[model samples]
Target chain A: MKNSIAALYLIVVAFNFSCGQDTANQVATISDTPFTPELLVEDVAIPWGIAFLPDGSMLITEKSGELILFKDGQKNTLSNVPEVYSRGQGGLLDVAVHPDYENNGWIYLSYASEEGEEKGGHTAFTRAKISDNSLTNSQLLYKGSPNTTKGQHFGSRIEFDDKGYVYLSIGERGARDDNPQDITRDGGKIYRFYDDGRIPEDNPFVGTEGAKTAIYSYGHRNPQGLIKNPKTGDIWDNEHGPKGGDEINIIKPGANYGWPVITYGVNYSGTPITDKTAMDGMEQPIHYWLPSIAPSGMAFITTDNYGADWNGSLLVGSLKFQYLELLKLNGTKVTDRIELIKGLGRVRDVVQGPDGLIYVGVEGKGVYKLVPKK
Target chain B: MKIFLTSYILAVIGLSLYFFQDPALEASMQRGNEIYADFCVTCHLEAGEGVVSTFPPLAKSDYLLQNRAASIRGVKFGQQAEIVVNGVTYNSAMPSPGLEDDEIADVMNYILNSWGNTSDKIVTVEEVEAIQK
Candidate 1:
């Protein structure tokens, strides 16, 4: 069309959808990222988690306590889901499939569960057998303790380690100081558990006085992103900071991550949560954000779908900024930062499909795919 | 002839509503929509269903429709005390939006009519200005 740069951006966008052949001019000017987003489906409600089945269908959880299977551009709600609290940052969130699912057929889910008639709830993880697109024989794996009416910070993302153990993160429920650092509490910790919902005896806090047996690592404010790097098999997480200091950390067993006591964040009222940023035995983050990006889901792209440059790059959804962020790493050290799919509105989750296309879910806009400019 | 004249008058009014609503109710609602997008979507949600028992749903809210002054006061001056919506008590403190009285009125108009809500009375700027803490 026109020779202007904005028009050139539209021309590449046109080719991304229509398969137009005017690529030679457009490809040279796409700034080496060569990618545009495509809408896949918007049928699911508040899609919080995404996991691909072996047959290329996707299992998605809506924050309102429903699960939908997106198959061939159609979505159908599955049956027999537990009743979720569905209150203030609490709901059905984060879904995962058993790594050895060819035999076990187990699908895992994490959601906020109502504790009683007292208007309190806690995050609960359950593993169920999905047969005929419905859950059956479900088992309660773990539930965060001391459910309260505070109604924020339900960090419940699930990642599976290579050794078939389950790693799940739970938030501090806004008790940044008390819950995060205490080993005996349920909130603000990542737990390692057997697939059958039993606590591992080797967990870091087991056999200790006044400690929860399921605690693996302690002192997280509210981690919303959890994943195992397919290349290194290390569990990494991204969490929201109070006012600033969102962080990304590589999780290690028995490690203290130093939340409220040692933080780079201040309270929402601009008061400091703590005066210290480092402590005696606590670990530090590999990457952190100031002024807070409110990150949600994250994934490491191991596919060559977008060519060599995009492979193994960490993609995280920014809720406050309404964009997807690319954190480039040169062997675990972040070297560059790029933003993509700008102004698409509050990215919620990002995952690389089996077909190597990046499937990202955004708030109110639903799920979309980011494809490299061909 | 009578019906035709009535239809013509209605058309003129509709046209005036579309093209020239500055400082009027329609203009207030338009500004309100933008203000809601900027400030309220994160906790209250896009559809205004609100978080269950926490943020208190704005869609078809009986509480908002019933307690008009309290709702205006809450938006104008931050609410920290417990309030009930649809019989569910909510205690979460809402910080003051720091918007002017006219901006509050505009956003109030936007919320009053959105997501299965319809209001017979308009929230005027003067009403918001009269609120104190």
Candidate 2:
């Protein structure tokens, strides 16, 4: 009887272990690629964002609040850049050029700002025009309210859709329980605004009572990666989960991406946050990473620069594992995940330049351009 | 009978003293553990064994053990300078976690005592507040 009970106990333990492992959606494997990385710009600490200009120049944002304009093989530190709150994870976060930059000459920046009466700082999105290596006529588009001093979770990625709509994601600022589930608050949300920073009349929460009107979606953790799919014009984002639940979500207006309520992750102490991964109203992620690759910058390869097989695949930077991940997609479904550019220092951001080449940003290092071997 | 009673009393006292710990420190360590899970665990990892060459380990860490004030200052402000840990040089920047003084003290106490480390001294909020940038 004693032997039989011991065998049953072992079987139960094995069953529980397998059940835990089954929750992890997919694992990526490293594969060889035809591209080699060449250092394009050097000596950037925590290169957070990279934006290419119309004249083939590049604009990069360092986490320490410096904006660099790389033109003519020289790095010029642009002046008149707005002051940023350079605390923990807060700083100048992401930058993007307007879709019709040639016509309007507008560029957008998202940074952690201590503008309001709040003691610390919160994520702020602004648009400005660049001339003579300086920002002019800068306008603050959106500022998250009730600033917090907590150092983590400042989701500030900028993207523009085909309709010229600007979307900015703000993290929960480490207040997961209060901010993510509440629409009246600012953090843990993606906001949609017009090119001129006006809230769209048709935004999902326009008429809702006490709503933040600009909220496009709520119930997000800390989304650092936001992009507009060039082929479909749909917005997609990847967010950092607590321990194991890093997720890539397709953005839908007014949708609740259940965060603290239902999660594939737990507290960093290996304590479970929730038992349920699915609920009625919460939208599930298109893809999620177990053991969290700590994904940051995101881009979709639109050109055959590397080859036809590379086109339309998603490239995401891994901050924890220090590599770039390629997710093979089939109509909004991630079919396979392949690791590329392994052993590069903490990949911070990835962007596809206008010249049909890929650019990656690394922490404590400079940006590198991936050149296809001829 | 008198000798037996005296020995039993001594044994009970010894065991009680051995098992007893300051309740306040215990409470602070508990809170600190939660803070560590939320903030520090991402870079330092769950076991305090930070990523090699990227983030230095806090498990049985010589740097943390030797430099108490500097460690507090690193947690209070951001750590940017190069420092050697266990004969490995780590130059990466650790941004200020922006934690409050009490939270920093609690986390310090928790890290000081966790992961095969022991500290007789308890970190206090005053100690954290005294640390300057």
Candidate 3:
């Protein structure tokens, strides 16, 4: 019996040694530098889009139509934000400072507002001046297609290109079938407008009637992530798909992207959407996630803070994965992927700050900075 | 020999206690409940019985109780088709919700327990990822 017990012990020990798994991949201690995601602003409800102001401060837009200014690790809540149509995917979305903001003092904001009767709400961009900590001279710059019941599918993301043109992403607003058929509809499209919110005469769809002249591209679902490549002057975006096909596409002027027609994702019940992942005249995504990462805010890595490996890479904040994804881009292709922060709550947006530090905003955990550790 | 054997048994028991029992379940469940209230309660309903004919009912769902893989996959990727539950068909669109696997497992556990459903198996994050395919 003693020899039998010894044999059993040896077997168990061997099994334990073989079965031991590493836990370092699961949880990580929050770092202070080289990237510490500490809470810089607290008690903000569902903060979504963030724009860095000229003076190194930031303007963050909450889903509930509150625009907050963060400076020196303190928050100053600005009031009189226009009453937003605060429903699903509605409310104040992206806030951006104009390229000539230093001289113009013009700040542009995107929000969903109630349209005429029978129409639910549409996304509208407004330009205003921030003086005395208040929004003044607020004027409507652009308004999206109106009349929809479902409160979801407002792809309101804003960015300014190197040419000083503001690019706005509009979702299909849950209207999947309509995306492929109509260019006149503002949903499922990217619109490019001048600083005054007027359509550029040289816009790709400028001569098309019924179609909004400001439209730059079409055939998108709800693109939530939009960023301009600082080096190559390229625009990129990622949007949610029906069941599992969330996509990241390189933005091109006047390109028709395939929506409900062509998708790698199937329906939620494992039903196939469309076998054709690419169609003629429809642009293809540079990269896509099969199981839907629910990617939200994305920023291009322009600096060398994360070493040379991460330079020219893209940091994508994954909401479903609850991680910050690093995408190494070679030309237009995303070459590699590294998940930096895991077990952290939903990361909302990532931004490169003036201090050469990377800042990331979490849904409930506040904002954090990624810097090299000492 | 007797003293050494006794010490070895005690060490094994101590390590088992430290490793086997989940220390995070209580806190995770609490946080899961809070998250459910804010994000899930609207569609899944306050009682976890999702809207009939629109959102499939999560209460005592065979999909929830039997097919753990499908349940996790359904949440990971939004369900946007006609899914039958308990002989009833539901056709609706649910957007891919933004939730981590740990939280997803915690909520699945809560659903499996509270809503007239019972299962001995605990949903783990590993199980959630394994069903991603």
Candidate 4:
């Protein structure tokens, strides 16, 4: 009897030892620099898109449809904003200042609003001039088409090229079948247009029959971040892919990103969404994250104010793990990745401030700046 | 020594039986907490208070208390269009948690009891299975 009890104890102990799991929330980095986070502003509601003006004041869009200009330690709530469908994952989203804002003063706003008389909402892009914290000459730039009754995916990120063109990314709006693959309607396609809203004639599908003239690329799931690569003059987009397949891809004209067809991710219910990981004509991700980071806003680090080693790295915000991901790139490929600054709440956006410091926007908390350790 | 060994063996078996014998409702409720943590906690929050005006409150929700059948159906399947919970209407889609019948019952019990809610009866698996649409 004593021997039986001893044997049972040994079996339990061995089982426990074998079942131990790795629970580190952060991935190891190549060479991580120890830094500190400084709270810049507080008491803001769901700060979504953040852009700095030439004068250094920041334009931030709250998800609850309020636009505020934060400058000099004060938040000026602007009015004359359009009504937004401020429901689950739908509201006032990304904001951008025009490339020639100093001379033209054109400010852009992306929001989820009612699709005319349609049952659901569509992401609408509008541009205006900011005068004394008020919006003027606010003209509707473009609206994503074929709205349906869903609120989950509204990929509304805007990036401007140095060559007087703009790039806009829209999500599939849960319409996976006819949206991402079908080029006739605008759902999961990236649009390239003149800054004033004219569809570029050189856009990938401009002259193609039954294809949306504004479409630059197709087959994107929910591209949340769009930025122009400073070195190569290319567009880089980072998007959330179902459960695990978050991907960062270099955008090409008329490229098929392979959303539902080929994915490294599965459905949220843990079932395989696709069996094929790669196929013909579908561009693969330059970098993919398994066990999704729920990627949101992203920015390229141009300055090395933190250090020269940190210069030219890409900073991505994670809504799932609530951390910042620093991707060290070898040219266009991500060679190394590291998770930084955990336990800060859901990171919504990571942008470079006018002062060359990295500023992050959190969902519940206010903006935080990464400053050199004193 | 023989008598002592007999009593020890009996005691160990009795303890094992007792440890495995939890009331059905309590076991289900406990399992439901883990399921809730995995699925519902992100948008609804941990305390079930949910995001204001965006996600409808689940804590002592009058809508859940008044329309138990509809609530079960809403959770078991999916809820779309619009729903008025405590005078506030939510127009967003609440995706089905995509759980088994037993899991649905357990999560229902866990939610209906937590956060100031009161219930005299446990939500049975059969009750959840019987809920249509």
Superposed on all Cα atoms, model 1 deviates from the true structure by an RMSD in Å of: 15.1
- Clashing pairs counted in every model: 0, 0, 7, 0
What ranges in model 3 sit over 4 Å off?
A1-34, B1-133
The segments of candidate 1 whose C-alpha lies over 4 angstroms from its true place after superposition are A1-32, A116-118, B1-133
Query: Compared with the true structure, what per-residue lDDT tens digits does model 1 show for residues A1-374?
Result: 35698888988868753642222112111355667788887855467899888888888888878898889888888999988875557889999988888788889999989754545788999999887878999988888878875557889899889987898999998676679888888889998999887988888888899998888898998899998988889999999877667899999999999998888777654667788889889999887775477889999988777778878889989877667888878877776677778767667898888788889987665788887778
Q: List the DockQ of the predictions in order.
A: 0.04, 0.40, 0.03, 0.05
Model 4 over residues B1-133: C-alpha lDDT tens digits?
A: 9999999999999999668754886788898887676557656667888755567889978988888889889878767657788889765556454466887888888898788986778899889988997
Point to the candidate with the largest lDDT. Answer: 2
Candidate 1 chain A, poorest ten consecutive residues by summed lDDT: A20-29
- Could you give the DockQ of candidate 4? 0.05
lDDT of 3 at A139: 91
| TM-score for chain B in model 1 | 0.80
Q: Write model 2 residue lDDT over A126-240, tens digit each, in one string.
A: 9999989999999998899999877778898999999979999999999998999999998999999999999999999999999999999999999999999998899999999
- Candidate 3 C-alpha lDDT tens digits along A1-374: 99999999999968954543223112223343255456667765566877777888988887767789887878887877777776556778888788888898988888887755655677888889887678999998888766664566788788889886889988887667875447877788888988788778899987788877888988888888888888878888888776557889988888988888898777654668788888888888887775567788888877777676668888878776668888776787766666777756667788777666777877655666675554
* Docking quality class, candidate 2: acceptable
For lDDT, candidate 1 versus 3, the one ahead is 1
lDDT of 2 by residue, B2-106 (tens): 999999999999899668977888999999998887678889998999998889999999999999999999998878789999999988777677688999999
* TM-score: model 1, chain A: 0.89
**TM-score for model 4?**
0.73
True contacts kept of each: 0.00, 0.40, 0.00, 0.00
